[model samples]
Target: MGTIEYTGNHHAFRDKLRRYLDEAVAPHGEAWEQAGIVPLSAWKEMGEKGYLCTWVPQAYGGRGLDFLYSVIIMEEMAHIGESGFMVSLHSDVVVPYLFTYGSEEIRNQFLPGCVSGDIVAAVAMTEPDAGSDLASMVSTFREEEDCFVLEGSKTFISNGINCGVVIVAARDSLEEEPYNAISLFVVEAGTPGFEKGGKLQKMGLRSQDTAELFFNNCRIPKANLLGQRGSGFIMLMEKLQQERLVCAVSALAGAETLVEQTTKKARECIYGSGMPLIKAQEVRFALVEMTAHLKMARAFVNDLVNQHAAGANVVVETSMAKFLTTDFLNDFSRRSMDLLGEAALDDDDVFAKALRDGRVMPIFAGTNEIMKEIAARFMGL
Candidate 1:
């Protein structure tokens, strides 16, 4: 809907992915939710199909696709109505750190596996006390003769249980300043002293494998450090724009699916005098209003996607889009539930699931409140 032109290749890719999800992912959505985690096989299949890390260079065994391919994946995954698979988190958010900052040896060791889906990736940044304010993290690392010792725990880490490798952010124990004290390291799952806690029971996004990760004197070779020492904060800041944009894209797509489902319900649900719910003025007005909001959000987010693909600095705009679309998603889901009344009460109701999943959108990828603060600071308000 924005200025980006979709080539025939892009259209073909989207069509193929849509079919694959219907066959491979959509059917397992309920089972994954019940299991509290998407199975490793599902991730491998996604990787095998080249749907994971499409932007990775061909040198790393990726298709070397552009950012638009990523957008297509996010949109289609949202349409399938399963938030737990977290392909975008692995492919776009976490892998970029490894590709951009990891040393050549590190890239060679992990990038192919990541692209092939043999390894799932995660980023460990949030702690029990530190959510959006990363400078407050208490995790510490100290450099030894040839390795670094890490000590601390991270909670609410997505893919904690299933990740083969995690990018751990910890501060230098000897450094006093918070911002400059931080650094990132690639810690494999089975490394001694690195413990992944049990899956967390969450209010929503139940299938997502969120858990606590403990690093008790975890040691890794000096080569595992991503980027320069004490550059974790800078690296994180540089990549946050894309992370938030991914959230915005997913939120908007989820909202679109919800509205489409609810509108269809409205057209079929019988009202007084045996007329459809859409015949009622109240129902019609609600659907109309939701559609109007979605159209506006679509335009805004699509523009941001194009800007992001072109490598423009749209941090302020992306932050705004993230909060706005997620807020609308939650609002629209709630209204759909109300408008549909008893019809939306099933255990597997699409509207109900949307409501539960949408609640967390504003909280993650930096909270909606943090998004506002960022926008205000950048706007000099």
Candidate 2:
């Protein structure tokens, strides 16, 4: 049961995806990253191949696959050297909110598009000053007869520009208590007063399509409220386990790729004495240590994924996984750069890009600091 098997059906899936990525996804990475956005066509191509929302139910025009498919996609995407598209953020992170909490009508209306990639989804929760402390958000929404007029701004929204729909978290009232006031809504793109702001260029994940979103007296029907009013905080909390798990998964894959790549490069390079870098005793020791760490992380993350599949709550454990894996990723990237020597100057390239991109793992999906805080609480510290 501990085996991370890519055999049989999984093997077929991986092979098919490799062909697709080589044809469509891989070739576009440099152009998309350079342009600061991935085109809609790439996402549409993924959807056509049933790779966008694999877990969605068949009744909603999806393949109704299990979570194993998601794990494969996350790892393979990293393996294929494409990170900025943020497909997991769509299929796993954002769309689940709709699948879990969206009303029947809402699900029927949007799930098909989501599965088909016509409706890219983004979650709008973080604001200019509000990030991890979601309870302290200043954006508020109020009932306006048959509609709710939302007024707020959200930044660092991935897929902001390409999203056809966004699941926005807003306080129902101008109250300081987030628990009692927060609610989620399905706000379609181009809704009146819902304006898409300029894209915010970032150091990495440049093709992420991140943008600032503004809601100025934005009006949406009451039917758009997800689940129950005032349950937004709870909804977000419920999803944190998966979200953090996703971060951990991606971090593990990134670090794996980095170690695998750097080790090969080290083996190929020779000093004046003609000794490959891998020949050094300390270098050998370091590689062995990293191998051990990655092995443990793989086992731990796989166990948690299995737990998640079995419907077991793994909030604290996933938090530990998230921070530990991401923290290791950051350290691994920096040290790999050290081992590679002058090769570190190859910016705008994979090795350099890996370092730049790896820098973000500690910051996203609630920073590593926040991850530790959650773990401490669960630990009774």
lDDT of each: 0.94, 0.89
Question: For this target, which candidate reaches the highest lDDT against the unseen true structure?
Answer: 1
Instruction: For candidate 1, write residues 63-95 as lDDT tens digits.
Output: 999999999999999999989899999999999
Over 4 Å off in model 1, which ranges? none
The deviation in Å at residue 119 for candidate 2 is: 1.0
lDDT for 76 in candidate 1 is: 99
1-381 per-residue lDDT for model 2 (tens digits): 445655588778878887877787888888998888989988888899999889999999999988888988898888866889899999999999999998899999999999998999999999999999988888899997799989999999999999899999999676666688999999999999999988888888877888999999999999999999898999999998999999899889888988898789889878777889889887778878888899999999998998898899999999999999999888887888877787656786577888777788888889889988998998899
Largest TM-score belongs to which candidate? Answer: 1
Error of 2 at 290 (Å): 1.2
